[model samples]
Target: MASLDDLPLRADLVGRTPYGAPQLDVPVRLNVNENAFPIADVVADDVVAAVREAIAGVHRYPDREFTELREAFAGYLGHGLDASSIWAANGSNEVLQHVLQAFGGPGRTLLSFSPTYSMYPLLAQGVGSAYVAAPRAADHTLDAATVTAAIEEHDPDVVFLCAPNNPTGTAMGLDVVEAACDAARGMVLVDEAYAEFAHDRSQTALSLLGRHERLLVSRTMSKAFAYAGVRVGYLAADPAVIDALRLVRLPYHLSALTQAAALAALRHAPTMLARVDELRAQRDRIVAELGRMGFSPFPSDANFVLFGGVADPHAAFEGMLADGVLVRDVGIPGTLRVTAGTPEETDAFLASVARLAPSPRP
Candidate 1:
């Protein structure tokens, strides 16, 4: 067998590992920020029926445009959006990869904040673009001034703004989005994969789409929709931005079954999202309880909470895993991130923490 070192791998990727969390076969899995709730059976049945119906057309390639699915997504999003402004792929990750392919490459640079989505750098590098991890505020927040300054300094070809950013679970104000759109000399992508988990839904970067052509807001069904296994992600942006992505996407990239299943799920959008409020409650509970337990939990607006004050994050993670609960050790010293799942999962996580977590650092 040949080793990776012996193969002709790209120099940038030679020593890099794939982006992922530990997928342990534990009884409790709050590690990946997934919607731990099972899909409503009625919705699941509809999805299965849709997929079965779609199987009849599997002999042919799917609709290259995925028109009806885009229309469904538009209706679901409902900020005066239509199919012309929607683009999707296997997941939000691929949707982002398409954006990088269209806008970032060898001579271009991609910029994002540290402790942001771990995949940003890998996606940029895979597209042959230089990646810059800009510094965030002292409290792990990104302010408008910091964003504008980074864009001014790097002159990057692409900028990623992960709203309600990952690992930290810190929400970004739209002011920061406004600053990025104003300051970026190139494409600006707002990753809102966890938007549904936010406390406020009235305003998002999506609201700014009519004004800025470079502004792109991406969304995914993998989180709040309990559709991670279905692999459906889409974005809403200016038609021109959608056009740019169309240029780089593979032919019939989205399979018919996926489109059918996603469309069926969207038809039950209300039912699919019924647990959002409950999940929000769980997230708040984690934040509050962690604070009461002497750990410092950040004010999160997403479906997960990132708490600090662990004496040994690795040990805490290991202990929790051994106790049949799994949380993410996102390489942040003194911090660990866990998804806000069911009430029972929360109970298990808290119990494991009480058993294993060390005293808070004064």
Candidate 2:
């Protein structure tokens, strides 16, 4: 078998690794911050029926515009957005890819704070856009002045903001978002992938949409909706922005089955999200327990918690993995991330932490 080096790979992709987390099968899996609750049976039945109905017409290309799905999303997002301001793709990844392909290319640049989603740079690299990883405040928070300063210094063609940011679950304030939208000379993308898990979900960038035409807020069904496998993600922006994405999107980008299933899921939104409160409880439990155990857990508005102060992040990870538990060792010094799942899952993780990741020495 030929190694990757044997092929004429893109020069920029040389030595670059693909974005992924461990897919290890375990009794309790929390590495990826996935919503651990199963979908309600009612929602599942509807999804199956919807997919079955879609299968009846699979032979035809899906509604290329995904018109109804967009409308459904607009209704779900409810910021006075219509189908015209909506865009979607296979997942948030593809949605971001479309953004890059449309607004980014050879000579353009994408800027974002560091220790973010980890995929921003890859997406930029994929589109031949330069990726800028700027620093955050020491405590992993950002204020308006800091955000605007970075925007001024980079003068990037696109600014990516991951709210309730990954690996460290801090949500960005609307003030900072406003500043970035005001400062960036080009596009501003606020990724709210975990917005539903935030304590105050109402404090979203959606409020700033009408004011900032350049702003785009991206979201996914993977986290709060527990629809990771369904692979539905979308964005809300000015109608003109949607038109730009249309130029770069693949024809029939979303399949009939996808459209149908997502629409069905939207219909039972309240039921589908029934466990969100419990999940939030679990997240808070993780934070409080970690603090009691002398680990410094960051404040999380997402379904996961990123705790630091571990003496050996890998050792703690392996120790937990040994006990049939898995958590993320997101590559920050002394830090590890764990998703808040069911109470049972949280018990297993917290127990594992007590055994392997004891209090660090002062």
Candidate 3:
């Protein structure tokens, strides 16, 4: 068998690994930040009917523009957003990729804070853009001054701000977005994939859109919408931004069935989100219990908690896995991330952690 060395490949990607978390066959799986609840039966039935209707027309090409999906997304977002300002793709990851493809290329640069979504740098690399990571505060927080300073120093072509950030689950304030826009000479993309799970929705960067034409807020249905299986992610930005993305996205990228399923789920947005409160409660339980047990849990505005003070993250991960629960070891020293799923799943994870107590204090 010829190794990769024999085949011509992009030099930057020579030794890089694919982005993923372990998908083990564990009884209680809370590794990814997925919604713990399943879609409501009513919504599921609607989706089935929609898909059935859509399959009849699958012989024809899907709407290249995904007109209805964009409109549906606009209605769901509803902060004065319209279809002209919306863009959808397989997932938020793809949406971000589209942004980078249009704005970032060789010689251009992409910048973000450290310990953010692990995929940001990969997205930059896929576009042949240089990726620069600035450190966040000791507490994993990013203030306006820190962001502005980095923007000044790096002078990147694109800046990514992940709100309710992954791994740490720290939510950035709107002020940070405003300051970034004020300082950055390039486009600013705020990844709000977990916005719906935020403790306070008002802190969203969407409010800054009208004033800052260069600011774009991206969201995903995979998290709070409980529509991960459908693989629909969209963004709200200036109509011009949406227009730029159209130039790079493939023709008929979203299948008719995907459009149908996503539209059906969006119609019942309230019902689909009914379990958010329950999951939030479970998340709080994890934070409080971890602190009481002597672990340092970061304040999270997302579905997962990134707690520190572990003596050995790998050991805890293995011990938890041995007990039939799966969590994420994000390679952050003395830290691990676990999603807030069903009450039973939460109980199982808590029990495993209790058994693995006597961890090193931070």
Candidate 4:
């Protein structure tokens, strides 16, 4: 008998692997770009009360259709989206995986821009699809020409775009997204996990849903709503796409408790939006301070900013960690991405950076 490790594994997975971000135990955690604020005490109590009310029904199976939660999400977004046009999963991450499973497979291709959310390619590979990326311009702007060229060349089965993209924080305009949707031969997925912080109107790819049968918009409550722990996210698309996702997803994928929590959170979305405004103001202040300190962070429409052209980004990352600050080293040479924390946390991070005495590399 051959050893399990020695035996030949799936050929496709030889070098392919799982995805994760760095986790560090630090006081001021600015990594992962999570909403720095916790759910308000009153709101949290409401969620707790809702969960307790549903706890008695634990023996019963969850709502396989997740209808109530879907309706709540639609109400929260201020869209008259019907349950038929919405689908929910454990998280937007799972929602993304379901999309890949439904559309991506052997011989198919998944397309996205380089230095994106990082999960796009990983999800594509998980479903046995080839992943391709076209690099964004130096300032992290999506190059319509490059994207158009790639679509013409690969003709991918699915294209993923992260708006106010992670690690870069640049938002794509409506025209650029329309161009990609027009060029796509199969499906176009626009991930809007950070849209609330954008300070601009969301050019939801949903607007193109009718015109382009292949468009899907994925959203999450994790960032804007501060419900990361609840693990609920949704996708909006045509009914046909929603049906396909439902078919692929596990029945009862979202727990009854999760549904209740999500609904409660949605009811308070206006309050959450007010909190988002505070976070955005803090983010702007941090970005401006960084510029004054000689760090060139790209103009961001998201909660985090990516600064680069440093002499040693990793070193800076380590230094910040040592000073009790935690951020992500996204491996874009000379660039470190930091999430905007509370005002005090922001000041602490700035002070730590000042202590590093960083000098820009020419």
Candidate 5:
């Protein structure tokens, strides 16, 4: 037998590590930007009933094409999209991976903004594509000129824009997004995972789909519908793009149980919208309180805030953890991201921050 140490591994995966969000057992958890609320009891009961109905046919394979769920999702969006233009996966994360796989590979490049979603880089690597980034301005906004210049220079095959981006919570303007889509020689993926919580209605790149054959808008149930554990996400694009994803995805990739649960949640979207509004209000309150306490919290349109400009971010993070509050210490040097939780959780977190406040030192 050959020695295990002598075996070769995929060269691209060498020295690459798995990606993850922090998991810590602490009170007042606010690390992940999960919907701070859970499914309402009425909605839960409906989902349970639907799942039970689905289980009655457990012996049969689920719809390999997920036609029913896709139609239901399209109806919920009411964005004038049809089933032919929609596709689903376990989560929006998977949807992103599928898009990268379909469009990216050797001799290709994936372009995005820096200090954005960390997963973009990992996804690019997974698809054997070179990843590149253009830094956001100090105000956390994209500079279209710089991005256009980079596109001209590198001529990447895919571009990813996370509206109301993760960690930083900054959203790109429509003009910036449109320009990026126009400049890209290949596909442009706009991730709207947090769009439901933004101040304005989601500016879906779907509107540009007619003119731009390479535009895809990705959305999720995890953040808005509080269905993270259920793991249902979908993408809206041109029928051709959706067909390409269907070609590569595993048949029956979406389980019957997930389909049923997602349908139930979509049926109760109004209730979910109410919860999102409440969380948005809570996030605003928390940001205001943090400001009052002398912390420079960035303006946010998502359910979390990225506050920094502090002298010792790690110390502040540790202090919060010591006080039994858990927030994300995004290693951006002197920055921390905190998800908006319930009123009680918010109070506890703010109290912890107050305790850490003192003579601010550089």
Candidate 6:
């Protein structure tokens, strides 16, 4: 029973808390923005076979570079990327960790706009880098001018742009991304963890990669690929960037089973992604329903919607939980976020919230 204070810990982490979201056991779980559908049986069988092959050699360490997985990832991305230009790890969080470890340090700073993925600042701090936040537009938009001006002011060594951003589920325009890259004197990291769920795939920062060596686009199989349980996330960037990441990545960081499973998932990428349209339909339904109910649901390009006008977000969240539907109260006052789950799950959530009859914020 030793307290953290009793041990020698990093001074910066002394007062910080771990990133946590409710993992409640509920009949209708929508707190996290996960793909509601399970992997198809055929694909699941392929995964089983691939993993079985991996197990036969699990006694030894996996390929340190995860060559095959990287190749499969590049093929899936399909922007003429090769294995040398790709890198991956346990999850998108780890991909960010690698970026921070490679480019961030005590004297460097990591900057981003506010109301974005909550983990960016923490990731910077974890790597002993200074963190700075600039407020987004009043309407929760990130325009080129705003991002460029902030880049000039902060002069950070790294910048993080979360497209199809978490919490609010807004996407960054290509203009903003290009401007941010041009303005930054250092690395520009575009986190597209929810890219596959975007309304327009062409808006992704990946299209900017060939033009900017400093640009990096991070993605994950967790959300749209129904591979959250497999924990595979990746990035595409210049080969030099990938080389820098190799320096800090632990030897054999990815397990053989993980590599095998991810490769198998990539093989059946189309099938694994077949549920996206259904999920998008449900997402649109949620937004429209919320609007009709007198709430302000943000227009989302991701699988979840961040709706406002709740009298008390936490109260509404609790009410929903009481009825067995779990959603997130992302600490945005008078706002809450819910994933676009199955039709039945969505119906249950809508019914539960309708029962509460929560009023809009004035």
RMSD of each: 1.4, 1.3, 1.5, 2.3, 2.5, 1.6
lDDT of 6 at 86: 99
Question: Residue 341 in model 2: shift from native, Å?
Answer: 0.8
**1-362, model 6: which lDDT tens digit per residue?**
99988989877788888998888888999998888999999999999999999899999998998998899999989888999999999999999999999999889999999899999988998889999989997668889999999999999999999998887899889999899889999999999999988899878888889999999999999999988888989999999999999999999999999999999989998898889989999999999888877888898999999988888887899899999999998888888899999999999988988875555343
What pairs collide in candidate 2?
none
Off by over 4 Å in 4: 1-8, 15-17, 357-362
Clashes of 1: 0
TM-score, structure 6 vs. true: 0.98
Q: Model 5, residue 350: what's the lDDT?
A: 87
* Residues 1-362 of candidate 4: C-alpha lDDT, one tens digit per residue: 78656868887667655677767778999988899999887888888899998898989998888888877776665555777788888789999999999999888999998888888877877888999988888788886777788899889999988888888999888777788888988988889888889877556665666676788888898999998877888988888998888778876888889988988888777776678988998899988888877788888888998886567888888889999999888879888888998999999999998765456334
User: What digit string (tens of lDDT, one per residue) describes model 3 on residues 272-359?
Assistant: 8889988999999999989878888999999999998889999999999999999999999999999999999999999999877665
Candidate 4, residue 82: CA error in Å? 1.6
Q: lDDT per residue, candidate 1, 272-360, as tens digits? A: 99998899999999888888788889888889999888889988988898999999988888889999989999999999897655564
| Candidate 3 deviant stretches above 4 angstroms | 359-362
Better of 3 and 6 by lDDT: 3
Model 5, residue 112: C-alpha shift (Å): 0.5
| lDDT accuracy of residue 116 in candidate 2 | 89
Candidate lDDT values, in order: 0.91, 0.93, 0.92, 0.84, 0.85, 0.91
How many Å off is the CA of 331 in candidate 5? 1.5
Residue 232, model 1: Cα distance from true site in angstroms: 0.9
lDDT of 1: 0.91
Minimal lDDT window, size 10, model 1 = 353-362
> In model 5, which residue pairs have backbone atoms overlapping below 3 Å?
none
Worst 10 residues of 2 by lDDT: 353-362
TM-score for all models, in order of appearance: 0.98, 0.98, 0.98, 0.95, 0.94, 0.98
What clash count goes with each model?
0, 0, 0, 0, 0, 0
